[model samples]
Target: MKYSIIISFLLLTVCLTAFGQEKQSRKSKNPNSAAAEKGLIKVSVMYPFAEGKTFNMEYYETKHMPMVAGFLGSNLVKYTIEKGLASGIPNQPLPYMAVGTFYVKSLDEYQAAIAPNRDAIRADFANYTNVAPVILVSEVVR
Candidate 1:
């Protein structure tokens, strides 16, 4: 009888463990899980400064980024703007005047959100910088 009770207890414990693992797997499979678990894609727009070029930081911060946020809405998880200070090499010119990074849950979401608004966004570029912007889309691994 004691042996039978021990065997039954072991079976119950195994069943509970398996059930808990299945529940965890289901939660992870959920689309609305934590942002880190979902992975992120970054879109970087870089503007290289030239000696005779123009870049309106005021308009970019005041107007352009706001418009971008409006268009992208919730799909734009977050964003950051960085002003280039100087190159690590002493006295060297900065490679880029400004860099804007936009993060989203997935590339597909970014493409969907940006496709329709591409022309509008491009039109605003002239108001901010004369330099042609270099765009890079990459996945965040870490």
Candidate 2:
């Protein structure tokens, strides 16, 4: 009888342990469960300008960044990187580049914002550079 009780207790403990583990696994699968899972999805756009196009660089830094930030403000986290230093290679020119970031509650918000203002955005950079900028989207997983 004592051996049977011990065996039954062991089985109950095992079942309880397994149940807890399953619950934990399910929670982890939830995207909003962990803070790390709720990072910013950044849509990056890079523009490569032609030579003697310093005006393009100024437009981004002085005009575009400010206008965009006015809408985003402190609600989003952001950064920008520009590469203009010479490499001494005559053929290869250093192009102007900038990245604008906006943090939203979900991917839907990101999509919605871009859908309407897409044309206005492209127009905003118009008359600045002949070459179209490379736009790449990314998420901050960490």
Per-prediction TM-score: 0.71, 0.52
Find the candidate with the highest TM-score and give its number.
Answer: 1
In candidate 2, position 50 carries an lDDT of 67
Q: Which tens-of-lDDT digit does each residue in 1-142 have in candidate 2?
A: 8987787678767867998999889887885655643576666666555654433667777787666555454544555646455423333456544444455445566666556767766787764555576777676674
Clashing pairs in 1: none
lDDT of each: 0.82, 0.61
Error of 2 at 1 (Å): 87
Question: Where does candidate 1 stray beyond 4 Å?
Answer: 1-38
* Model 2: number of backbone collisions: 0
Q: How many residue pairs clash in each candidate?
A: 0, 0
